[model samples]
Target chain A: MSIVRLLIGGATPRALALLAALLAFLVAAPAFLGPYALSVAILILYFAFVGQAWNIMMGFAGQLSLGHALYAGLGGYIAAGLFFHYGIGPWVGAFVAVAVAVLAGCIVGYLGFRFSLAGVYFALLTIAFSEFTRIAFDHWTWAGGSGGLFLKVQGGVTDILNLRGGATLFYYAILILAVGAFVLCRLLLESRLGRYWLAIREDAEAAQAVGVPVFRCKMIAIAISAALTALAGVWNAFYYNNLFPETAFAMGRSIEITLAPIIGGLGTLFGPIVGAVVLTGMGELFTDLTEHLKISGLKQIFYGLALLVIVIWRPAGVWPWLAKRLGVEERGR
Target chain B: MSGARLEIEALGKRFRGLRAVHDVSFAVPAGAIHALIGPNGAGKTTIFNMIAGVFPPDAGAVRLDGRPISGLRPDLVCAAGVGRTFQIVKPFKGLSVLENVTVGALHRHADLETARERAGAILDALELGDRRHQLAEALTLPDRKRLEVARALATEPTLLLLDEVMAGLRPTEVDRMVTFLRDLNARTGITVLLIEHVMRAVMALAAHVVVVSSGEKIAEGTPAEIARHQAVLDVYLGDAAGDAA
Candidate 1:
């Protein structure tokens, strides 16, 4: 609490100024960057948003889901399907998307937690559900089967209601999403529910003995994580103008969702954001460099090396080390 | 019978026919400090596990103030006014000492603010106020034991079952714990059922003692009575019987 207080009220003026400047930079980024660079910025914000969502389950509650891409993919498909078929806007479709994802999360969370599945078994259960959903989508011709689903492309005027726009619109759209996720994660982390999660994460038995409702808390984590990730999926289909089950619900996509928080800091508030920016920025940079050098696979090698270095140097992730270096008043939990 | 805060009714548990605990029945009258003692692997902690709802017993029942809590989940058992500390001291290692207690305090206290306030008071009572900011993993064994007690006490439990809280403490530390527990019982009238191997602390703190060996109850009486029992002496407290008496 003192740490929370210190960060909120007693932090040095320099740190406050730095934060304000960073916020200003993010808000004004599109004015200075070219269209190509802005697209990369949009990707960073997208990862930042989804990373925070994934962090809620694995970081806050310690429930590992190796199939988090299921939420994003399902959300995108449902919203895109509504827009394509019923002429409905994604704004209205998002609710249905989130509900479907939450339902999926509940089934998995209920089965995993009720049956006492922990660690790898629970991870496998999540993967199974995700794979099942991907397969179901692959054969469903109404949702485009294995071909893919695409929103109407913009040739003239950008429609904000339908989320039909240029790169700048999505840049702000995902910026809002990433910021919303950051705020929500902070709120949950400081609230009573967050304490229960940390308790369960530490030791479920000890938590239960202390009257912490382990199953309920775990389910809530999964639900919230899925709900948030589902929103990202909605934005994803609109921004990219396409949804492919192979790319969206694949195991590789889930790994991409997890990398940011794991690299930044597993359970910290700023870890996902910082990790997203670092990983996404570095990834783009690596891709650009490799393309210039005519080395196609070097980008993957860079990601592997970056993960290895972070794991070896800072096992808790980059956020804690960075926060301490900047004197950000983190309690080092 | 009405005075008894905790009652065990021929409680029995079997680990696939291993007979871990069998037909053990006892009661700690409200405001009493009771002790369950035995040698290693004698199912003393197993009995605590049963009462705390770590798992349901295969046979018989446990009642708290005329309410059956035998088959309830551990959280439900705690919500029914039972709080317990593990024999191995399972503190939430990732949390601070204050946060650890606050988790239990929140069980009864409605909100985080009040739960934190109550947890602070409990820490002060247990002489852990100074170390409340430290992570549970950073604390010494004695502090960890007190932290376990503090965490349990924060639940505002009518019954606090402590499993070997004084096992690894020094003589002075054990005496300090005994004094603190005695004052706590006097002040709060919370019924305590502790499982301890420390004869000095057990003798000092427990009003009633139940001796167990080989998963079955050998004797039950006042501290001095159990300390002088022949079966207890032969099976368990052979040398420490004199010290306890």
Candidate 2:
């Protein structure tokens, strides 16, 4: 029963219809929107996908990470490097990126779990690793180093197969990634592994007493999260056609990826999606406001204010409040 | 039904130059109710921790079914059919009662569907069926304690370790718990080892008893025999007698 429910997204009939309608609108969005609006939609979906990737680790497994850029940066470099140097397509490079990301995740997870580093300390460890990688990449000469790596963009009609397509192709790609991430997260939440993660998250000692292999479960969460995030990184690289260690691996990038889920809701399926929409929409609004007023830093201020309001008034996050208002009781809580 | 299943051989633990437990040895026979009673800070819980593999013992061994399990991790020990509850209840506060038990059941049943079915049955058996959908944080203290036991039981343990499960309960609730545990033991054929401070519940439930004081065992016998043991009386019950007088 749960299998069928999770497969269909565990929504009521009305919610199912609402979701289908929303997805259909998003799928056909490019036809109606201008280039600028389409770009914003793509940005929203990109953040949503990456945010869901981070959610698996911190939201489900209760492992807070502040340096998710490690995976994203590594993924971008691997895919771009293969395409730029070895003439490999991102189609195959994506797999390599995922593999490398999972491997890095294992190493970090092993070190952190072995040393019993957790919570803020674990978050710090992730940041330290990402920063270290960024510094190393900055000095290295291969793949353009500090100069940045750029992919060959053949100017023509949209090339959907090669990912050299226009904004429309990128938009659809991000939409697919976001929806895929949501379904994957929902399925994971109903799985046995998900139960073990919640148990460990709630109380590690009690979880161990109940026969949960805490370390293994945590490692699995980290590996899966890193792999998924790497996919998003590959997408980002292909869409932008360039990668700079400073921008790609920045601490701000990690914080930006996590902000959506934190505002939407931490442990819910649609939290990242909802959070991404709100954050991206407000960001666009603030950018427009700043442009008209000739003011800078309004975007940052808006983000800070949104985060403060969510943390204070809606600690469980906007998704749960929205659910309550909509009279929808979420399952698998 | 009669042979010893868990044997603690001179188990000892020390923390920062303080001996929390030392030279503690006892055996819980299969299908028997064994109680470990001690005064506050008497190392009863320390002994429980050692037996449950929460941490490695400084010295000596813990054996389950004549096999050493002292240094095994808590999850491995539980996998070997030894389940335990914390003195302070640790339910998954964000989870429903069924979800909490399902986590425990997942230890034995890898499939979530099977685990959920078994967890449901366990909750029903524990009289928590009506509250299956409620968040664990919403449960009252007594119900939470029952949920704790229900969780451990869902693991299908051969030997169940309960820590201070009767604390802070009303008289009627305590009685209900005693009856519940007795019925559980009779139905499940699980060996029971409990660390408890409530003497009335201990006396009514435990057939065998070990008394401890200040990190050492003071007496070991049947509950009634230890109730009258001179060392136990002087260290524990004698104080109660003096307070009453």
Candidate 3:
């Protein structure tokens, strides 16, 4: 009966009960956790939200974007830029960020779809755009150029209203965003457009022959994905209270955002969320191990090994394998 | 019934130096079951592609119901009352059988539930109702072909273009498909333009037959007339046509 469950590929009663338990655990988590643990939890949720956004493009729509950081970087700059120059809060600038990101998506989608750039070419184009933005932002004086944009923290107390606060507010913000994204994606995957996307992903020619507006549907996918990614970017900028084009729009950042969904599962609704939790959770564990041993870069090595193992053992992702083990069947997903 | 539901005028297509289809013209009257027959690389599928707007012909025009459909995108062609099944049976393998059909149903019925219900009916009509929830990839070759036809039928097209719908079927399955195609045309009054190599199906169902060879329409007539055509014997059947006679 819950809206979230209804939105999530029409979750069965058992799935609903499980989801309720998970939600309860997440809600009560902050109460018992210390600041460090809370931050880790927030980071996990943050990645989960972004992962969901990326999943819309690659997972559902089957457009492999390797430079998703383009959206996030652009969104961050817009929000941060507005706040720095016009004294507009990120809350208000979020709209501008979305608009800009959608516009960028349209341009990229137009060029890519128009020229029929697909597969590795599409991925390269996305990376090229992100790289271009990185270079442009590096030279732009209004956003502190290469020096990076830093938001001045007032006093020391948490500023919940302005989003310049402690990690707790961000945790809740990201939690809400992740929930919203999940519901939205669920609704999308069940809709007519989603069906068209699935068809297009399977065979574009056959889809077009069946009256699906293939190019338009793909553009919509890209635009929606960019908008969602931009929202996450805006949040990332405000939460970190700083922006550097190098780190913000880095290709590595895009890869990081996409790694979880790929490792977890490609098209399933909960793949990204589950993947983020596992990935971030393992990352933290690896960092702890490295710290105890006084070694650096162990986390990176662990990530590579994890990815290799997942690719070898569970190519369809952890979610599909886990779902099979759990006897959960979602139709047409 | 009425005149031609689909008209191709001087249709020609080229892939670099190779002429896939050249000045190929044909017409399928409304409510008629038409067959386009040719040997391998004779441009039968190429003509279908042109009519279905897979790509614009280098020269010529396609009109459906007196409306210009040439140079239109494939989806636009479909929207203009054309539905097609691929020669290779390109089913949405990841989706369930019902979902695969539902994608076409969504063209006319925008509501997902209505489209789903319509897709269900189409699957039932195609004798695939029991496997509606099964993934398309899990189906046998015959079932995959059936799913392809089912998906095309769900679009409610005035003209249905089937590219070798009976290519790999067993003899019994081929007979069943022939019966189904005839029944479909009789029931829905939908025009059928099919490319087929099955001589029995061609003789049994096609109201008219057009033969192409080397990217050109070599002959067009009733099935019996095509059977006697000298060029069809020379180019298509070779010694087989002589043996039949």
Candidate 4:
């Protein structure tokens, strides 16, 4: 019975099956798709990865951060600058970017926790810090100030040394990252830290009264969340081959990254992925419809309406309703 | 049985201009039931908060097993073997009854399995085994009070500070709670410092009683002595001393 249950009930087997299906689709995708379609797929996965990383802090740890794009921007700039200036490979640069982002996350976490700032106050602090970083980066001229930095266009499929080889390479690289982010979130959801995080989220004072080191646990959550988001930034820079302070550090970008998890199911393991797919798919449809009809501002109006409807009708997000329908156990309730 | 002793010297707490606890000094001996009784605003809960490291005292020292613990955080104080339950009962509403207890167990026990085992044992002992899987918010008032005790017990504290565990209990429920407290102190040898307004329960359970009125220690004695004392009678029955007769 145990063996039978394990075969049917374990997340591992289900995840493996899903991976196999996705791999099959990816391998056959290029044969049947054009450049635009492939680009859309890459964008979906990129947002999915970022959403998952953000979910770790906001959803799981219950620390609402509104300026997550700051870490992403920092990671992207660090990796892009390292590659452009020192001719360093993105593989090594990604790790350094992640480390720096983790350090920044720790600082933010310390400030919030040490001051006992929580809920909306913590979110405001993150926004304030991100805005500060954005202003500082905008003034720094080494990375082209407010103009931007663009990588040189390469002419081959195998220019792996330059980290701007081919569209197909970028696609596969981001796919791996998306999968890695999902696995990391899954691991966190099932671990001791996850339980501690849930306890702290539920009642921080009570958790401390029970001897849970509230500050240290929160800092750990922030660090892990920042590191993962930074790694996604590395891929973002490499895939686009262009970095700009405004585009990378915009408050809109942070909101876009968070919207996926909010619409998917905040705090649930699969909420970010589900949310990313829905939003990205809808965005693609909206863009195509607007272009064909020559309509102005339709996409923005649609997104705003959708967000309002979701918040009003199903505030828990799409994944929770889907989980109930499909009989799947939800995590971090 | 080998729990640490709690000592408070010159403990004082002020809320703005008013002194809540003034020069309060007491010692909770290991493995004994001590009661702090007072009127509505006698600073009983304030003393508990200061002792449990909820907030630093204005001018005092709290020593746990002879180690100075006045400036430590609540979690640090808990780790050092001091556990307390709030008078209002602050349970993690989203977590299950067992999970709420498990959070306390996680302090001393690192692994989930061991913590679960300990939590299960505590739940059974607290007569909450039937509602182990229920959300804490779903529990009734009496159950919530039981959960508070269970949560504190799971922390494995040497000294337990209970604030009005029998505050709203009926006569039978109060008797049961008194029996449970007595059994816990005798069996686990956990030193109990209870702040209660229920005169009957306090007189029946507490070996030593300390009374406070208007943030001052008005009387300290055994149950019979306190019940017969003129000061306690005046404080409870008011200035009309002839009304008691």
Candidate 5:
């Protein structure tokens, strides 16, 4: 039985079949693609994973965090640092990375929700925290300061446990992660907790009148989201073989994390993946085109135009509209 | 099984310098349909807010079945067996009608399937079963009002607070709501504390009536007694006369 059909929500059987086929195609993708193309596929899966992490916070719970790169960056530094300085494996270090990321999310969620900072104010608070981390990490010499941190790839042995393997190994690992994120999000969406999240997202005061615990539910959203985002950070460190404080905690990177879900469909189960595919595919295509044409900055302008067009064309996003056209749309979504 | 299902004594609130509610007290008996009636801005809703824990009073105490509930957060107040409806009737716009009520029902069942079943039952009882899958924001005003009441009832509350659930309702719709509420109270033995200005529904549904005027409790008795009370009459007819003059 396909995992799509096993999901608790009542997706149309046609939709399930379509999803299963897409997964099969992705699983077989490396056979048909070159090294460079395989790398782009890896980028899509990464964005899909991280985008869902951000979606659970802003999309499902409606608590916007504009500085989500902090979680990823912090997780990467912790895991990579442990692996580099101490000879611990990335698998073991991932635990510590996830815990730290959860702690950071909790602190930010607590201060924001407790003090009634909402919407743009909460977003600004997140940006401030990320900015603070960036500046602090730039001066911290122990972790290589702004110059960056490098993972010492072991000389001869290809240790899969340590996450030192070929590109295909990393590709399969990320595929499992993206699929896992989708399943987990579906499970959470089908639970009683998900109902409370929707209520809080729509009208928090109304939710409280009928017994939904707004504060605690929001906190849980952030914690789970941070934990998943941290795992993505761990993957990034090992795959890239290096991390720079400037690139890891960059404000531009933080904004990019939100682009996928917003363009695909916020709060929908498949929005993040769909958003990831379109945005990353278009972004890479534009970058390649601009490079070939000897033009420098057309990539960003194209991205901005795509975002503008999508927002103006379908504010609710491409997935909802596409689902409707495909005859697989859920009611009341 | 007890004295008052809900009680507030000397309940007072102030908005900066202005006293919104002061020296007001009342007790609602178990299984009774009670009404708090007043003209617009008479602080009836203010008293409701204090009881439902939207805000604490400047000075007073609120009790449910003889246990203090004042100063609890709104969600905690609900967990303490109180459920409330807002005058504005803002349902979760992204959620279906069933999902909106299921959020409240989960308070009792603590799971998705049972909560959804309970919400379905409440929707059927409230004649919203047909529109169960519709987005809450898509409902008509009367339907939205009914959705507010339905959602509150799904919580399995011992005491329900209703703030103008019948406001903006047509006469026939109001009558239907009154009948449904009266039947609900009689069948379930759930206590109801309603803030309303719809006198006809008040007379039909409420066994006990409390009237407030300018943030002060002016009268309290059976509906018949309150209709005949001079102070209640002055607050209503006197205000009308002043309006005319």
Candidate 6:
């Protein structure tokens, strides 16, 4: 264990150097790339951030949430609506969104925990809530209902006042959010709560027998997960300058968020990031291939196949494989 | 004698139509090693379960230090200074031996460092220091029993309810356990309520003995007194009473 720690401590400098170089590369990429490519990069970072947020609940705490996108959608809509109607900045609106998400998360967590609902049942509850919220939002015309709300396009490129600007702004903004989410998850996974969560995940009955407040720990996980996911929602709203219930709160969107962590490695710190990169890269590659071949629904088919293959071949996910190569200790039961 | 007392009054637990335990009553006085001896299906474990709050009795009450604790959650019962080990030891199979005890320590000490320190001390005292890093599932049956006791002890319970801890141990192992229990009770003054089938060990260690037959307390007295009781001889000794000459 000391040797593992020493290796990790020694690698910190090199890791930081690599991260710095990657940041530099990303910062410079938009300067030379076309508008389309930059948009894709921004989307990749956005998914990675949301994936990390979802990872906190599902990966770390082992709480499967099929409706996590509800928090993200609600967060984005609340922030975007508040800003559009009351002249609130996205910065202030983001906190409100997070607060709302936490409250909603608590409600969901309480209902689930109170009834001792877990495994597939908990996942089903999340989906049910998200679907209910989506339908309600679809009928609410203030945010344009099913037609969706589109932000007024600013005439100039440097329209920072309205948070509507060029591709560079979105890219940098999402990069920061993704990095922040990664750091937040890292800190949480190393803290006392992390071990408690792991214990609960491994054996909740035994954990409670030993004095871990199982419900409270699970609630905390949900709140943190919701708060981080809401921040991603705020980013989604600002970057796109649009809100639509079907697209934002869809089950497909939740699955997309869950897939990153599932594919990369469910519980590891870097699993979500790796998963996000692979899913996003594959998505982009598939889109290009489909466009050239004029194949309909090819991307979804490919993604489904990929998921099935990964589950069959490497059920533990990509992180274990990467950990072996990188000499990091594998963490999950 | 640390003033630990466990009292069960008219405790009745019925499963569907069958009464597993009926009107069973017993008191384990402070600082005494009390043994509950019964034949198989005599409701010894069911009585322990009720005291440990595994299930609330259909009728009657359980008290710890004169405070009613019946129907309370298991963790709350533990917090009220009543710690229990299961008849079938349920250690956290995935966790290491040290981590298993750490969970108990965490109940009283929230801080991981303090919990770890307390757990380490317990492992040392239990002679489990060498196997602290091994997963609990890999431990031998005797070690698992020790770990169960250690885990319960880490909770710092004033009253320790040990259920058939020596069930599968060999004679020598049982002797070593008897010595450990004697030392623990003598030094720590943690009141012990042990349910056991080993008549020899129970007779040697228990200061007070309660004999149960078919969920009813047929006898309660000192070890020697119970040993001489004809009812105990009839219920427990059975045909072996002739060999006891």
Residue-level lDDT tens digits of model 3 in A5-95: 4475456777778788989988888899999999889988888888999988888878999989999988988998898888888888999
Clashing pairs in 3: none
lDDT against true structure, model 4: 0.84
The recovered share of true contacts, given per candidate in order, is: 0.79, 0.90, 0.92, 0.66, 0.92, 0.31
Off by over 4 Å in 6: A1-41, A155-162, A292-294, A330-333, B1-3, B137-142, B169-172, B198-204, B223-245
DockQ (C-alpha based) per candidate is 0.71, 0.85, 0.85, 0.59, 0.80, 0.37
The weakest ten consecutive residues by lDDT in model 1 chain B span B236-245
Q: What TM-scores does chain A show, candidate by candidate in order?
A: 0.95, 0.96, 0.96, 0.92, 0.95, 0.91
What's the TM-score of every candidate structure?
0.95, 0.96, 0.96, 0.92, 0.96, 0.86
| Fnat of candidate 5 | 0.92
C-alpha root-mean-square deviation, candidate 6: 4.1
Regarding lDDT, does 1 or 5 come out ahead? 5
| Ten-residue stretch with the least lDDT total in model 5 chain A | A1-10
Please state the error at residue A17 of candidate 3 in Å: 0.9
Candidate 4 lDDT at B87 equals: 95
- Candidate 5: lDDT over CA atoms? 0.89
What tens-digit string does per-residue lDDT give for candidate 6 at B1-245? 26498898998988887878888888988888999997899889988888877788899999998999999867778888887888888887767888888878878886666887899999988889999988888999999998989988888889998998998989988888899889988888889999999877898789999888887888999999987888888886685784664
Question: For model 1, what is the alpha-carbon lDDT of residue B113?
Answer: 73
lDDT of 4 at A167: 78
CAPRI grade, predicted model 1: medium
* Candidate 1 runs further than 4 Å off: A1-16, B1-4, B237-245
Candidate 5, chain A: TM-score against the reference = 0.95
- Looking at candidate 5 chain B, the ten consecutive residues that score lowest on lDDT are B1-10
> How many clashes in each structure?
1, 0, 0, 0, 0, 0
lDDT of 2 by residue, B1-245 (tens): 22238999998999999999999898888888999998899998888888888889999999989889899999999988888999999999989999999999998898888898999998998889999999999999989999999999889989999999999888888888899889878876789999998888998899999998999998999988997777887786567775554
Provide all candidates' interface root-mean-square deviations: 1.4, 0.9, 0.9, 1.9, 1.2, 2.8
Give the native contact fraction of candidate 4.
Answer: 0.66
lDDT of 6: 0.83
Using DockQ as the measure, name the better of candidate 1 and candidate 4. 1
